[model samples]
Structures are given as C-alpha cells and as structure tokens.
Target: MATDELPDRIAEIFNGSTIFITGASGFVGKALIEKLLRLTNLRKIYLLLREKKGKAPVDRMQDIFNNVLYDKIKSLKPHALSKCTAIQGDVSQINLGISQEDREKLKNEVDFIFHSAATTRFDDTLKYAVIMNTRGTMYMLRLAEECKKLKLFVHVSTAYAFPREKILYEKAYEPIADPQQVLSSLNWIKDEAMQEMQDKILGDIPNAYTFSKSLAEALVYEKAGKIPVIIGRPAVASFKLTSSEFINHELATEHVRPSPFAMMDCRLPVFVTFCLLRYPQLKCLSLCLRMHIEIY
Candidate 1:
C-alpha cells in the first residue's frame, strides 16, 4: 500500500523518510524491513551489510529478502524492495567500515537510523563482545552525529542488559563498567586473558552478551548529547510461534491470564506482563516472553 493511501499515523510519519539500518540480515532487522515495506511508503531504505563466509554483502542481502519472512511483502508490493540499497560495511570496525563515498551519501540522504548491529551470543568472548557491541555503538553514534538531516536514532538493545535489576525500567540504568575503559583494556589484554577474566568482569551479568550490551547502553547515555535517540531493549526473540503445551494446559484450567510479575521469575514459558511506567523523553519497547511494555 502507498503511504498516501494509508491514513494511519505511523505511515504518515514515515512517508518520504529515508532510513538507514544496520544488521539488516538479522532477524529483527529483516522483520523491521518487511514491515516498513508492507505498511509504509518510505523514500529509501539503506541496509548496512557486511560480507560473511564467502558471499558478498549484496548476495547476503538477496538471500535475506529471499526468506519466507518477506513473502508477505513480495505479494503485497513487488516493487517495494527497489527502495532498499545495500551498503557494504562492518559495524565492528572503525567508521562502521563504510567507504567515504557511501558515508557521504548516507549523511546527505538518511533521515533516520536504526543501529541494531551486535553479537547476541551469550558465550561470545569479552573482548569480541565489547568490540562489537560497545565500541560499534560508539562508532554508529559518531556517524549519526554527522547526518545533518537525521531525525531519530534507534538503538536496539537487550532487556537482559541489566540482569541484576529486579524490576527493569525503561530508563537508562548505570552500566556495569565504563565503556571507554573497557574498550581501552582490550588493547593490552589479550583474548586469552580476557577469556580468563570473563566471569570476574561480567560480575552480576550472566554472560558477555548482556555485559557488553549494558556497557553499550551507558556509552549511548554518555555520548548521545543532542542527538535524538531512543533505546529499545527486547528480550529473547523467538521466530517460531509454537506455544508450550504445558503453559496452555495450566492456564486453561486456571481460566485467568498470567501475572505480569511472572516474567521476573523467568521460569514460566508463556505469560502476559504489564507495568505502569513513564519515559517522557525516551521511547522503549520491552518484549519479554510475550510481554510487551511500551513507555514513551
């Protein structure tokens, strides 16, 4: 559907807006691209893609669109994908490894950015995780700063970033460590040494993934400055909608919806959670075990 044909608020807001997205090959990125193509008539969608294995970035992007996730968009708007252009880049590298030509084009054309590139593996080495998640975020922020027409920068974070907190709020909480200090440590600390000290470094955080993400959030808080930014912390994203039979059977007998607090336990397989919260300046969407909490 065209943006003009859709009278919804979201479609109107995004109409004619040019967007740049990192992690365009990931699950969340693919889903976001599909939705924008299907629901909104955005002018352009620039995808930051890094070559992996033996394939090139453009080939990887083609494979991403070939997935079943985009089947709906293909049927709805066959030409919608023409708006998407793949930019060769690696988020873990300096300046996101984007060429000067591409960088200049992005700065001039992009109106919004979604920085969703990061390693989500729990077992990632501390050094690798910091370089990818924490430092990568800092680099993306610098790029955002250069975009003269940029309106909003959305940082995709994880809900488990602050595992120590009992009630995770929408606002930015203190990070586990100073991101810059941690990044600097990587220069002197070898990968093996970093691995040995991983547990000690993680402290309350369960894994390097969450720990690095926490530090990335802190970096954003410190460096966002005048940039219009919003942080979204989403929990485990299960692509398959298959429900646990045990949860269904138990809930059927009780005849009541699960409590929102059930999510805190992290034991239940299925439940809906609700919490009253307010984030005046920041917008966040927390999706945990089917629980959706949106604070704006």
Candidate 2:
C-alpha cells in the first residue's frame, strides 16, 4: 500500500486497542507512536522506559511529543496525551522491569506489544549486547507469555543479522551457537577476557551484533510454535538518505547507523510485523529486521 493509505489502514486495525511499545524513545519507535496517534483511535499506548541520566520517562516522552513531527498528531487529537502511558522499566529485565502491579495491569489491559528496544552501537561490548539484545528478548517473550490478552508480540530484528552475508534472502536462519549458552559461559569471564574471546565465540560471524541477533531469532522460533508469531526483516538504510558517499555507508552496518539498528537483538524483519500484532489476540511477531549492511 502507498504511504498515504497506510495510516488509514492502520487506524482501522488499532481502532480501540491498547498497545505496549518498547524503544518508544528511539527514532522508529517515535515514528510508530506518532503514526498511531495521528491515524488511529488507539485506546492507550504504554511505553517501556528506563531511567536515563536522571531524566524521567514522562519528561522524555514529553520531549518526543513536543517534536515537530508530532505537531499534526497533537493538533488532530487534542487528547493525545491521554493515549500515552509511560511505564518505567528496562527491556533487559524480567517482566521488563515493571512492578508486579504494573505487570498485572499490562497483562490485563494491553492488546499489543512492540519490542523495538535494542542497543545499536557498533562497538558495543559482548556483555552489553547479550544483555540488551539477546536476554532482553528473552525477558520480553516471558512477559508476553504472561499477558492474558496479548493480541500480538512484535519483535524488531534486523535484516543484517548475517552481517557478513552478501546476498540475503527472505527466509530466516538459525544461529551458529546458542545465545544463552554463549552468555552463560561468558558470565565468569572478565571483561577483557570476554572481549578477547569475541572472535572465538563469533566464529565466522562479522560482529557480536549479528551473532547475538541470530540467536534472538532462534529464540523466537523456539517460542513461536506456542503462539501466533511473525518476524520482519528490513534491508539496510531504510530511512532518510544521507549523502551519496554515505549512501553505501548507511546501507551497511557501519558508522552513522542509529543505536536501534547498530546493536544486536533487533533483526531486519518486514513492515508486516505490525500487521500481525493488529490481530487482537496473543501472537508472536518478528521481522527478519532491517538495517544498512554494506556489500563490497
């Protein structure tokens, strides 16, 4: 469908549903929230946020809402504020770090879940990547399993999960190694030692990002048979074009890639990931994911 038709179509899907969004502060997350508010009569949107540099989630959300792109949405829906609910938590924790009461509330009220939280830094350490990208996914899955009324669970993976693969495909691939195993074995190792062992663990994988992300995909497959699950994979450089010289750079997993795409855990799935979530029952959503992976 054309971009102009997407909002109206999406609006129809989420007419009265409540949604829980992770990575709501990131670029795509912000866009997703804006589009929903601008186009749909979404009942509520719960944002999963972690306290950052002493800033609160409400403050952070306000900053995003005050952005210029949201102006149309704000004006179109004067009560847009009522649709946004900020839930303080980290995706890396159990139950997304939400309190027991909040977890119960979400399980009861939320109809959709969008797992877009991931660290997108190229040089991120193995420990950090595994925790946020791999384990964080595990946590989200667990949370979704607990939700009594979940319609769909959308996990943002990457298209470059195989950073070294030149020509990719639409099908999903399994990880060379188990993510949890790698994480567990590295638990006792020192940071420096872990860094040094990165090559050994990754084998032919290009970086820790793709390696862990591959494992995250495996996690979804492992869990999907139990619920309705779909994965989306978006090719590299799906967003605004930079300069020509930077075009290839933006197309690959290189410098200038946003944090959301830079890190592992997120795969490059397709846009349909959101559609499955619109199904209105407990379902698993994954998109092979998207990012800019360069080819020589």
Candidate 3:
C-alpha cells in the first residue's frame, strides 16, 4: 500500500504518538518496533536498554538495527530509524535504573507503554525470576501511573501463565501467592531456602517463568487503578522459516525439535492489533494458537 493510501483509523490513532518500550531488544519487542516504524506515523520510540558486555545502550541499539530483521525498514524508510532513542535502564532495578531526566521526560511525553521485559528462562532461579517478572511489573505500573499523557499500558504475558487450567480464558486468574508477600520473602529468604521450597511455590505451574508471569498478572489486576491496561497473553510464538536454502544451510549441523503445543506466528500484525487499538473494555487479549506441521 502506498504511504498516501494508509488506513485513516490507524494513522489517526498513532500519528505523532510517543511510545516507551521495555525489552526492545527481545523478539517481540523488535518486531513491534519495526511495525510501528513501518506502519505508523508515530513521532518517537523510546527503548529501555541496559549495558551488557561492556557495550553501552546506544551501541546495543545500533546492533539491533543492524540485524537482518530491520533490512526492509533500512531500504524503504531509513528515516524511521532516527525516531528511536535508547534510554539506559534495567527493569530489575528500582526506578528501572533510568536517569531522572529520562524518567521525567517519559512521564511528560510518553503516550503509550509496552512492558515486555522479563526473564524467560524456564530454569532461572525463583528469586531472579520474581525480581525480573513480578517486581519489575510493579515498578512499571508505578511509572505508568505517573505518565502525564499515558493512554494505554500493555503488559505482555504468556498464555501458559495459568497452566493448570485445561482451557485458558481471556481473563486474569488468581496468582499462586500474593505478589507483595512473595517480594517481601525474597528480602529475607536465602537462595538455598528458596530453591528448597521451589516445588511448593510453583505447584503445577512448571517453572519460574510461568509462575512469575502469573504473579505479574495478579499485581497488574490489583494496582492498575485509573490507567488503561491491556494484558496480552500470546502462546508459543515462533518464526516459520520459508527459505529452503537458508533452512538447509542453517540446519545442516543443528538439531531441531518440534514444539509440543500449537504455535502462533510471531508477526507484526499480532502485536499491532492489540497495542494500537483503543478498546477500553478489552482488558485481556489472547492470541489464538494454531498447529504447524513444520519442525524448526
């Protein structure tokens, strides 16, 4: 579609809007940033990035855009890259470890927020997972409450957060434990003690990832007072590699395994639809999962 022929409704909603995104370097976050730049007339995108391996946030941001994922934007709309700015921060830290100037700027100018940063490792320690997923959500919610122009706060959660339910619904489920109490315990409980009680704390949730995500959802339900919130529960998302040549070469020596459950295509449309649409009554959005015969 021609730029002039872009849909008016989407354009009207996003034109000149300023967005703040955590986990901008992750799979979903990168895809969402690409879509916003390629499809919307948004004015700015602030990415929260932390230093790693001696590289500054700006350097990491450059590395992300250099990936093959941003090739289309580079050729078609290179100027869009200029709108993205990296703010130094870590979600696991208090105040997100963001500078006061940057925090104030976000509070004054940001219109939308996408909190997608979390430790996704299934084997991660319960303490680290809670700090990253549960308490990190609390900090984001507090910041969302202070945003002067905030219109929406989208929290990216997992479909399997409540795994005990055979059929998951598009609504919040009771967390395994109170999020506040969980956070408090982390302060006094030793790592060995937490590890010993892991089975009891997780119950049937499976791992730290899902268990922390469940608590995050509960925290959002309890604290998101007046703020417009949407909890997106996306199920096992993966890319379907269509190029035969790339696949053959890439898999020549690699072992590929089939995903146990149905997968959802991790595409721009999935994120864009839920993030940009102004549906006040739509509190929870769950992506429909479909079976894919191809093994990755």
Best by lDDT: 3
Tens-digit per-residue lDDT, 226-260, candidate 3:
68777777776655655565456555775864222
Q: Give the winner by TM-score.
A: 3
Q: Report lDDT per candidate.
A: 0.74, 0.70, 0.79
Superior candidate under TM-score, 1 versus 2? 1
Off by over 4 Å in 2: 1-9, 164-166, 237-296
Off-target runs (Cα >4 Å) in candidate 1 are 1-6, 239-296
- Expressed as tens digits, the lDDT of each residue in 187-258 for candidate 2 is 688889988888887777777777777777777767776755666655554444333544554557645553
TM-score (all chains, Cα) for each model = 0.80, 0.79, 0.86
Error in Å for residue 200 of model 1: 2.0
Worst 10 residues of 1 by lDDT: 267-276
Ranked candidates (lDDT, high to low) = 3, 1, 2
lDDT of 1 by residue, 1-296 (tens): 98667566555556898999998876567667776777778999999998899899889988888865566578889999889999999988887899999999999998878888899987888888999999899999888989999877777788888888987876778888888899899889888888898889887678889899999898777655567666767675543222365346437866676432221211111111011012324433333333232110
Which of the two candidates, 2 or 3, achieves a greater lDDT against the reference? 3
lDDT of 1: 0.74
